[model samples]
Each structure stands twice: as C-alpha cells, then as structure tokens.
Target: MYKKILLIMLCFLAAMACSSPSNPDNTNNGDIVNGGGSGNGGGSGNTGDGGSTGDGGNTDIPWTEIAPPLPVLDEEAIKYGIDISQEDSVIKEQIRTKIQQYNKDKGGYKVIFIGTPKSEYTQQSSLAKLVIDIAEELYKYKKYKYRNRY
Candidate 1:
C-alpha cells in the first residue's frame, strides 16, 4: 500500500510541473511550448498594432521633399549703396532709373528726396545729412508741389 501511494504522488507532482507557466526569459531561447498561443506561432510577446511605418511618423507614404525658400531682395539695401564703388555701373544705373520712375509714378504732393552725390561727399558720414537737406528743399519747391496737386 505504501509503494502505490508514493508512486501516485510522484506522477501528480511531475504533471503539475509540466503544466505550469514558463519563465518569460526562457521564451527567447525557444524552450517554451505555448499551446493555442495568440496570433502567430511565435511566443506571446507584444508586437504593437502593426500600423504604418516610414520617415514621416507612422505613415505608409514616403516623406515629401521640401523645396527651398525663394530668395528675398532687400529693396533698401539694393537701393542705397552697401559698397557703392563695388557695384557695377549698369546695375547702379538700373537702380537709379527705377527710383526715378517710382517717384514719378507716386505723384505725391510732397516729395522727400534723400541722399547727396557720392562724388561731393568723399566720406560717407555726410551722405545721410546731405540727403535729408536735399529732401527738405525739394519738399518746399513750388514746381514739385504744383505738379503733385495738378
């Protein structure tokens, strides 16, 4: 009777050990035998919700190439001389023509002419002062005022 009881207990213990859950770390080594496991035959590891994947977030579409910004022209800097002497005569003439045309088109009652001849003012320091003075004088001119009003 003692031998039979011992045998049955040994068999029960063996079955319990075999049926128990496996260690998570052992799943990596393929030692785990998961029955009815989820999804594929692979172990029960979280494989995120297989959504989109690429350069732009979780998107299926490839990243769009961005175009470079258009170059901006500095009107003031282009009008006034940065290094007047360095500018080509053709370009300078074009700028001058454009300024004149702009003024003519404006046809404002008051004109504010700024800047002096680069020739007279060898030094750039007096250029701004000369421009302001000339602008004031032009503003007071009868012809300029008359043409603008008419």
Candidate 2:
C-alpha cells in the first residue's frame, strides 16, 4: 500500500512538471524567441489593459433610466371617497391619503381592502369598481415609491 501511494504521488508530480511551460516568457538570456521571422524577436504579442469585465465603467456612453408613466387616478376613484372637485395636486394627495387610511382601517393587503364597515364605502353601486381602481393606483404608487429597493 505504501509503495502504491508513493508511485501515485510520483506520477502526479511528473504529470504536473510535463504540463508547465519550460519558460513561461519563452525567453532566454534577456531576449524572447518568437517563431515570427522578424528579427525584433519578442514572444509576447500586445496584451490589452488587463481584461476588463466592462460592466462597471471604461466606456463613453452614459447610462440613463427612463421614468415610468405616472399612475392615473380615474374619475370614479376620485368620486367614490369624497366631494373634493378641485383640479389641484394637493386635493389629489388628500384623496389618496383618505383612500389609504380607509384601506388600512378595512384590513388592507398590498392595496386591496376587505372586511370594511358599510359606513366607509356607502355608495354600493360604484364602490366595488372604485375600490379596485384605488387598489391598482396604490399598487403602482407603492412600486414606483420603492423602485430602488429589492
């Protein structure tokens, strides 16, 4: 068993020695001997600046991200919650805030609401569609807000 192990070790060493280049630079004295007929003989051909992966930098083109389309709160969604008819951004924000609060009180999940009291969404004829639209808006808003996050 000992002799067998020694023989295996010797064989592995021999294989490694045979695989390695005798002169990695293909050089002798101070000069390289390339097979090219040119007398300027140097084994190396010009290697580039150390093999860049190119994802991080080293380019002219600048990276830019196109902003996604803004979420549109439909007329029905605005209509269901309150009577604010102003065409102002502040009112829009207030409407969204109200919707979110109502959603939270009604056991909201992601953006959908459930188990709500009748008082909150009393307009039964338009309530379901309004809730769906509001939920969709909320979903889009959440995604946009957390765009950079995992």
Candidate 3:
C-alpha cells in the first residue's frame, strides 16, 4: 500500500515537474518542433522553476526614516495603532526611558519601534534580523509606514 502511494506521489510530482508554463516569448521547457531532415530541436528550454521569486520580492522597510520609538503606551498605541507587547516590563520601562532620552536629545522624531524586546537579543539574534523579516512581511502587505514620508 505504501509502495503504491509512493509511486502515485512520484508520478504526480514527475508530471508536475515536467509541466511548465510557456514564457511570454512563446517558449516552454517541454518540447520542440521537429521539422523535416533528421531534425534536432531549436529554442532554449526553461529549466528554471518558472523563475520563482518566492518570498524574496518583499521590500524592506526604510528604517533610516523611522520615527523615534514612542516611549509611553499612549504614544505607542496612537502612533503605531497597535497594542505593544514586551516580554519584560522592567526592561520595557528602561527601553521607554532610553527612547525618551534619545528623542529628547534628537529634539524628537518619529521612529517605528518593532515591539520586540532588545534585551533578549544575542549577537546571533539581533533586532535588525528580527525587524527585517517582520518589516518585509508588513511592507509586502502595505501595512508598514514611514512617518517622514507622510
């Protein structure tokens, strides 16, 4: 029974693998026309997986233009329009204070703070890496915004 199922799946995959959409140039990976005299086929076969972009097409958030992180709940809620979550409240308070100080020094600017905790980050788990994935996903959906642009 397992052999039969495996065979079926293999066949299905093979069929799918063999099948490809014709490019806008009227070419596909499949077949070639054999005209007359001992003909060898012409035209390049598209061996690519439909030139799959997959998830790589997502635009990165323009972080350089981000507003300062709103230090308090009211500002975070109002500016980001979402409830903020921090795994550690003591650190959250510290982060708020840091943001406030930074904003104060810079004479205040809008910055999007991805609500992930910075304290939890290791060298391998930097905020940039975390923010990038989330920001890309958000940008793909047109949900991420740059305050300066507005």
Candidate 4:
C-alpha cells in the first residue's frame, strides 16, 4: 500500500512538471508584447523623452517656490513685542543677548542659535520643528494685521 501511494505521488509530480511551461527564461508572447518586449511585459520601465535633471528627470509639473521659515523669539523678545526686523545691529545684539540669557537660564540645554540670509535659512536644519510653529503664528499675526488695515 505504501509502494502504491509512492508511485501515485511520483506520477502526479511527473504530470505537474510536464504540464508546466518548459522554457523558464522565455515568457508568453502576449506578456512580452504587453510588457514592452521585457520578460514580465509591463511598460513601467519606459519614461519616454523626459529631460534628465541629474537626480531624476524633470517631472511634467511646474515647481513652486516655498518661502523661508520665520525665526523663533526667546521669551524676552516675545514679552516685549519686539519685531525681529527692527534695525540690523539692534536685532543682532538682541538675538545674542537672548541666546546668552537662554543658556544661562536653561543650564546646559544649549540652543544653537543662527542668523541666516533668507535663502540660506530656508535650506538649514536650524529652522526645523520650532520654526514651523513660529511660521504659523507669524502667518496668523500677518493675517490679523492685514484684516485690521483694510
């Protein structure tokens, strides 16, 4: 009975092997045509005539310019209602003083302060999560001011 079962299993294995497509490398002709002559026959590999832009080709859509993030004020600046863009020297001194005060008060939780040109600021890590919050707040303030003006 064991021999009979083994023989039946062997026959089934032989039938399966024979019934399957013989050429492992050669895909079906319909698949080849549909796949752009590749084995899987999918045309996903083709990105026809798109201009190369080093990293990837320039996509079809136009790119929009994003504005730089707003800087966060230390507690004193926030308390005093100081605008960040008031004269350059005064702003610099105020920012420096604020950093020094923050360092003194926080006790070794060092905040890496930065002053950057608008373009560079947009590209830097110094304006990460905190900058996003400040930008949203500043946007609300600007909107409020605009509404009050007109």
All models: lDDT?
Answer: 0.44, 0.47, 0.45, 0.47
* TM values, all candidates: 0.23, 0.23, 0.21, 0.24
Worst 10 residues of 4 by lDDT: 47-56
Q: What are the runs in model 2 whose C-alpha is more than 4 Å off?
A: 1-95, 102-125
Comparison by lDDT, 3 against 4, better one:
4
lDDT of 4 by residue, 1-150 (tens): 999999999999999999887655443443332323333343342322223433234344433332235665666435333234344445445444454455477643223444333333323333344434445655687699999998
Give the runs in model 1 whose Cα sits over 4 Å from its true position: 1-83, 86-100, 106-125, 142-150
* Model 4: lDDT to the true structure: 0.47
Candidate with better TM-score, 1 vs 3: 1
- Comparing 2 with 4 on lDDT, the higher-scoring candidate is 2
TM-score, structure 3 vs. true = 0.21
Over 1-150, each residue of candidate 1 has an lDDT whose tens digit, in order, gives: 999999999999999999876553333233222222244545333222222232222333333343224432556434443343332443344344444555676654322222222343333334354344445665578578798997
Q: Candidate 3 regions off by >4 Å? A: 1-111, 114-118, 140-150
The ten-residue window of minimal lDDT in model 3 covers 31-40
lDDT of 2 by residue, 1-150 (tens): 999999999999999999987766543333322222234345232222111423222233333332224533664444334533332343345546777775666665322222222323234324455546656898898898899585
Q: Which structure among the candidates has the greatest lDDT?
A: 2
